[model samples]
Target: DPKVDVLGLPDWVKFIFLDIGLASIVFTCILGQLTTQVNASHMMIDFINNYFAVFTLYTAMTIEFIGIMHCAYLIKNILSAVSGKPILSNEPPKTGFTFAFYWVRVLMSCAILSFCVAVVFTALLAGDTAVSVKYPSISPPLAVVLLLFFMGVVGTLEAMQIAFFSVAKLPPSQRGTNWFGSKTCSLLFDGNGKNLPTFMIGRQLTVVCSFFLVGSFTSLTIVPGTGNNIFGVSDTSQAFLNYGFQGAVMTTILASIMWQYAASAFPVTFLNSLISFILLIVALCLEGTGICGACWV
Candidate 1:
């Protein structure tokens, strides 16, 4: 009765996720209002700049954590349901962990490792210290760890996709009368698909980031003596700065649209990456031409 089928999550679980997402929206609204107030008051540029970036990063990470938790639940239920494994129905709590719990733990561990790597890179690359300062001790290990963690996550997703597709491919002869229930396949493959719980959260994260970007520009415009201080955009040259702003806006629009509709995660990820690559190139060109120093930050 508890089999997962195409709906990888229970109704109650879905409701919980909805609540988390709603809560994040509320948080964003509060922060956005605060940002507006700060700008109106003409707060110190240094403080506003730092606060905005840190707040955006924190919100993104917070929503990402929520998404990862949702993903863990969906993955556990789907794997258990499809594999005909015993659900976590029990009379009392046990000291021993179940198979589903182990898998969830593994996924969480990988996520944590990746998070650490991200933190190291962010600190080293974007900290107040000059870029010349080398983090030689941490950089290499961080790269290696991230590479391994990424491989694990990708491999697991690939395995799950393969399993679901194989089940989908089962013929009527293989199954009793009908092919493996079409509903399950549709649930996993159609619309948003079970493979992209994170993308759902990402949609909101993008909106929050976009709002912050807009707020940053607004703060710079309204506050005296803040031009180019926040984003390091050139006061003299507007070409690269304009391109970066446009790119951010377009990225946010794309993300918002995906939030409304059910787009497959794979393509969304690809598009985001492509957009980011182009932005990075623009940033590099700007820096190379001495127009600005990391205006895209």
Candidate 2:
């Protein structure tokens, strides 16, 4: 029983607090949301129907990324144990690539925040007539504004916490006795303090690329009866046989290949990039020419 206390907390304490209590609370909240119909309409149901496939695809990709990272972590630990080398390292990255990626990530985050703000303003100004009709008592603009405000507040707080605690490099004196700063920094960087932001950026890129690729493909195929073939194709089977889907698939594949390089802390050399691009083009040509269906979108 003493040996089983991994975090210096009893097993029963963990089970009670985490497994039962926290899980029950989460379940209750979800149940409440389902019962109440948060949007007071079939909007939630519609959203699920329309976007659930893409969500599942993104979730699956993210899980795979996590699993890969976990495996790498396990292998590193195993090698460290065998060789008697410490897992932790105090060395900084030799290249400026990590800092460059970090700045790019910051810019991307700012762009996304700006886009969200624009969407909020557009929603406030455009005022959905259906939403207005659903809730006759409440002003549509007011409701939209209030919803956006609440979301903005929560997002801002979360972003601030991530920026300050996870990304920011605090001095040793400011890190405190508990070493929370070090733990946070470790989450963003590896043991050798390399790729400070690529891991996070790679994750985001994976999810976004997966979403666009899978979402576009599914949207074309997963429709009532026949399918939504905007390409004026005669056959529904070839509904996704279009430039858009090809582009999405290619983009996803390129991102995935680049992510591999980023994860390995290798700079994206022009020679390698050219080779990758040529190989992808050949693969796409083969798929397009009906020679192989391996890269089917």
Candidate 3:
């Protein structure tokens, strides 16, 4: 049976209208900032400088969206467990709304993948000079390597979505025959709990890595006093730290409240907040000490 919320609206409606709409708004705001900066400066240096900052912001936004989705899924599982109601079964789309929603998700995934590829190509064509000059601490080769790693992280996240959708689109018999299809099914359902622990561990690790990677870059390149930017005295590090920590704390508090209402248990919500704090500290340390091989001098 298809999932419907209390208001009788299908799950697809919420996912399409709410989740995608929010992501689009976030992207548009960031993109607008980049566009404004670019339009204000005709020099190549200024353009490249703004590009790096915008790119880092984009990466952080992507991480935030992914984290929110994963957290929502976790809460859904918790609700299902507490209520002793099985999750809605995964079946091929039948209704027009469901079919349109499925295709929209697929197309968005493809668009993201294409955008990632384009960015990678642009970075490569921009060459070592652009990267090295913008991030003067690291050697050109190492800077390029780091940029590629950032791109890879974003690409991999979206690629996983596309892979899952692809697998879901296949016939049940055909899904088992395909490696990604079979693995996706196992990871998605994880009825035996065999992969859930590993999945959560890996996801948390990715979140930490992404936070540090993007944070370190933005700290040096986008932080107003630190970098050669027109935006005066803006501290990207502090801003990111505030955003990350606040987001985690708020999400945890909300989730805990929901859990309390549903299960009548006041569970601790400090884990995610603590993780966010620690990750920010580590990133700040790396940024301050230049221990991550990025000396701004």
Candidate 4:
């Protein structure tokens, strides 16, 4: 029957999600070849000094988006409970003026803000004399600290989302999910006893994000450049990996939420979000293929 469990999920959901994740990974891998050469100023100190900070900010933004998405998914059930809510069945992406839509729009805005930080890198911070003085052309290493900050943001975002979701949605019977780790009395136990919140998605999202991080660094090394352009990632294989990182991370989170939540956001919001997620995931997959090709040679 349709209700059969595949990897602890309904078969239909498992299939759809796997499709989304797989397609994305494959498509992104293809973009890798076009971007890996680094010919113009590939690995140049000036380029790295100029671009690394911005790139780090971008990466952090991307990661933060993923983290927030993760939190939302984790907490979907709990949030519904807070409202004394009930589950809704699966349906296509919809559009409407629902409470869910209002919340999701706000969430998406915050999620997208991470990459928006790149706006600073694109101009304001790029050649800013003030930033240059503070960061210093000679102090490229300081960018590492900036990079750390981005990672911390990602981590904090993830932690915050996880805690909120766990407490709010998860049952007290599911004690293991508690802040101190699962204990004897998680709130999620049924009469027969079972963990209500299945958490495999967290592990899956982590795997997908790890792949993007690897692909990004690897792609950076091999990614060719075109005339000292700041937007090299846009046209090349690196973009696939970079954006794929965005995609895989984003989509995985989305997939989890889709699997767990009630789809109240009407068609436009849902469709747009889905498309954005798919595009990135495919780019990552293609990025991986390119990485493999390089290894074989």
Candidate with top TM-score is 3
lDDT score, candidate 1, position 64: 53
Per-residue lDDT tens digits for candidate 4, residues 1-297, read 446665697666666545324434433433332122232235555544657668978997886544445445435656567546565758555457654664675567446534433422342234421233332452333443443343333333233233434443445543243233332223223344422221212222333444433222211222335443334445464444433344334333433343334323221122223322333243334444443243223
Candidate 3: residue 97 lDDT (0-100): 83
The reply for model 3, stretches above 4 Å from the true place, is: 1-137, 161-171, 176-193, 221-227, 230-297
Task: Provide the RMSD of all predictions against the true structure, rounded to 1 decimal.
Answer: 25.3, 23.2, 23.4, 21.7
lDDT of 1 by residue, 139-256 (tens): 4435334433433333323333333334445552332222233333333346655323222223223334344433222111212244522244354433333233332332222223
Question: Candidate 3: lDDT of 198?
Answer: 35
Cα distance off (Å), candidate 1, residue 10: 31
Candidate 1, overall lDDT?
A: 0.37
lDDT of 2 by residue, 192-265 (tens): 64333232222222233233323222222223235433333355434333223433332232223223322233
lDDT for 6 (candidate 4): 58
Using all chains and alpha carbons, the TM-scores for the candidates as numbered come to 0.19, 0.25, 0.28, 0.22
Sort by TM-score, best first: what order?
3, 2, 4, 1
Which stretches of model 4 miss by more than 4 angstroms?
A: 1-90, 93-131, 177-179, 182-297
lDDT of each: 0.37, 0.37, 0.40, 0.38
lDDT tens per residue, model 3, 1-297? 235463676778667544334334333423433334334455655654767879988997886444432333445557678766666768753589865654465455445444333433333334322333444567545655675565344334323323333444545555444444344455444476444323322333343444334433322222335443222325664344323343233223232323332322111121112332233333334334422221111
Lowest-scoring 10 consecutive residues by lDDT in candidate 3?
A: 263-272
